[model samples]
Target: MRTFDVPSAPAFWQDPHSFFSSSETAQGGVFASGDGAVSVLGFDALDQLGRNPALDGHPFPAGGMGSPGLDALLRWGLFALTAPEHQPLRRAVAAGFGARRIETLLPLLRRAAVEHCREAARRGQADLVHDVAAPLAGLAFCALVDLEPLQAGALVAAVEEIGRQLSPDSAPDGTEAAGQQAEAVLEMLRALEAAGASPLMRDIAERLPPDTPARPADLVAALVLDSIETMTAGLACALDCLLRQSGVAEAVAADRYGWPLAVQEAFRLTSPVLLTARMAQADIAWQDDIIRRGTTVMLWWPSGNVDPRRFERPFTFEPLRPQARHLAFGTGSHSCLGRQLAAMLAEELAAALLPKEGQRAIRIGETVFLQRFARLPREAPIRFA
Candidate 1:
């Protein structure tokens, strides 16, 4: 197998798009690390791997992410579940994000978007991400679990604290302070459930079987953990794409109906949530080698999204391209459960903010990335007219 040392690859950390678009990954589409982990880069290969039952979706190793709270997040989170345990929990959470439910939240999302845009317009300047996208995501999250939108700031802070531990650059030895933060979040969730204040907890309880291993609060925590960052990142990236391209923002703003296609293309180009992993449950056959059980297979989403074999002019942004679908949200059983919510948030925010004619946002700073799966920029500054 071709070797690609992912940990030492500075480009992969500093600038993932260029790293994945390189000729090495475009040619072979597969690589093996010194630690025996395999990376799959082809769209078709990733699709096949996602569907393969021999691979387990549970992400954490046996020793866990270092603390009981962190370990619980890894073990009980929806994306990390496997087989018998996964289906029921998925169904429960999926109920909250159903079409009827999302439709009910549309007005709320639209109102929040308009309010944020109004504030930006009054100031004549704003951070496109922080002032707009992040707040919209926070409002959507509060709506989902039945919290007041006013509580969004505090809720977002708690989730971010928990999420920091999952970053690649997080300290190897979990800090005592970090552990306390995780514990506090978990304890608050449990307390909310006990007091009957969490509608998400009730939704899960209604759908989940009586003997289920996971607590209702755990499922709610997982949903909160997964929802805000990805939705916020996706909206910011799509908005960034529109602002950078010359006529695209004006065209999308005029059409209204075109935002979905625009967001889809942006997702293809930027490919948020760079990678996902699965553990081989049994021996598997590859092109010229065997993948033994217990091996970790990393699915590189950016590589698959830009595969030359699958996309014509793969590097270019074309919303109306013939093959518009991509693996930004992944595929198969463990695919993102909140994909619909993410798309809705992006479209609504774009529709609300983009006005008819000459008023629009102009980018003032370059986008950046942190050592995390989410490709969201720390600051994407813009001025509104």
Candidate 2:
């Protein structure tokens, strides 16, 4: 029941693990910020909280961003939808990425990975972030949505611009930036619709009832906006883990099966997504107090993965450790729908980047942190042989 201000200090972002590991956060597993927002920590606690109906997926608050166009686009996206409305849309989107669809795209995904990795090898030194991870994510996303590979760079750039509006530090920077990004998305969606829609978009449209409020293009945009950054960051993180840990890359290179374990461990150690927000729909009882209706609940996911109670040597990156309970892709109905595709891309990239016998990549600079997320620099050079 103690009210602590939300952790927004620069120092906190610089070192979130310290706060998560402290007794203060671990004691009750929940802390209330002065603004009535509640932050829930730990894997077990979040698993339990996710099942409670009172806390539903959060929506982008109207007028909060000072850009009506941007706010509208965000609100209409899948992340803002609730129950009844949310389930059908979610199912439709999931169906679009069905096993057959991804399986068919496997060769293409592998080819893209190989191409990027080959280019990195040609240079003998490359920035995996922009040169490899970003393009891989962008191209994979394009393939999923039936967009041309040529559009990948533009789409990726637009999504990055859109993402800036979602950050906690985001402030009203006038409507110009948000509006431009919104228009760019609308333009792309219109083009896709004109081109008779991608198979995924068509599947989504066919699956939903004619009366459903969501447009197929909106769902595609939602997926792109929500997933691309995470995918790019995840690949970069996994590579960073391999480079820092030593021998892991060679182990994976020798046995493709090890890719899953290494990728999962990377996710556990540094989740691309640090937190998710839920809104309390009604007054709910806590251990000794109440979460009033309309209060925002923050689920610090990375903290849960690193919780001392759940795993032995939580901070250490042990690829062999069981990864069953990590909240990397989150839990419950809103868990990542594109997780399979994301994992496949990472595995394929790893396979291509590390050969059975070749010089390995060495990090040229320290990994950078953007708030709680592990974001690589635009050019975090890595030498390869």
Candidate 3:
């Protein structure tokens, strides 16, 4: 087996397709990366790994492969564990982001779009990511997950700053920016607690048993941190997909139920959160090698999401594609509990931002991809008239 020496940095993430293909062709689906990590490619392989009861999704104290302070956000959260250990907290947090609850948040979601429009009106140009997607995601997270809407501005900053913890430069150790961001978010939450606890927080606490591994505050903080980072990335990238492809956008716009389809399709393409790592619980036989137990296995979802065998015209964004079910949110016990809510949020924003009658198609300016984390558009300037 050849060593897959892809560096653990943004440069490799820049073209995961090339890496996936080269790695797969070179090693027949499994190889060792430069970071001493084992990675697997292909849609079938990823799905099988995701459902492998032997592999653990959360195998780290702080969220896997992240910096200390940034990962500390999930220190009390269940994000770093698989089933059995993670189930109770997952259920508790899932309810808060349920579809019905999301429906209640429709007004806030629409308000985010309205506020973006207002910002554009004032400046004639603005970053859709920072101004529209990030703030919208931040506020939604604040109300639904944090239950502390007043700290939204700080949450936005913290989420952005902490997200940098995933950058190649900060890998394996928390960066100074990450520490500062964590301090900001935690301080804000601490202040909010001094005032009073919201029903959402209390409900989450009540749901967990006395012996639960996750503390109530950790659960709240984890949910808050997640709500902003990846959600914001998914929203920004999905919109970028539609805005850049007029043919696909027009097709989606023509359908009454197209917004969600567009979101799902774009999700398959970008897969904002690209790779998820799992630890093997038992020795597994690979093509010609033995994968020892306790070895870390990286499931590259972006590769699977665009696997030609699974997705016809894998590179194209085709809404309502029959084989459209993708692993943007992963699968099995550790799947993203907020999948439905995330989809709803994206669809709502798409509906609001999709070109209206007599209005110009939304235009996108230069974009900067995060490379790590969600591959999100760090700077997505956009406008419509």
Better of 1 and 3 by TM-score: 1
Flag regions of model 2 displaced more than 4 Å. Answer: 171-175, 253-257, 372-379
Worst-scoring 10-residue span by lDDT in model 1? 173-182
Clash totals in order: 0, 0, 0
Better of 1 and 2 by lDDT: 1
- Candidate 3 lDDT over 253-294, as tens digits, reads 566447877889988887877777777778877668776787
What TM-score does model 1 achieve against the real structure? 0.92
For candidate 1, give the lDDT. 0.75
Q: Compared with the true structure, what per-residue lDDT tens digits does model 1 show for residues 271-373? A: 8778888778799786676778988888888888888878899889888889888988888777887777788878776766666654567887787666678
Poorest lDDT segment (10 consecutive residues) of candidate 2 = 371-380
Clashing pairs in 1: none
CA RMSD of each candidate after superposition: 2.3, 2.3, 3.3
lDDT of prediction 2? 0.74
Each model's lDDT: 0.75, 0.74, 0.69
Query: By TM-score, how accurate is candidate 2?
Result: 0.92
Error of 3 at 357 (Å): 1.4
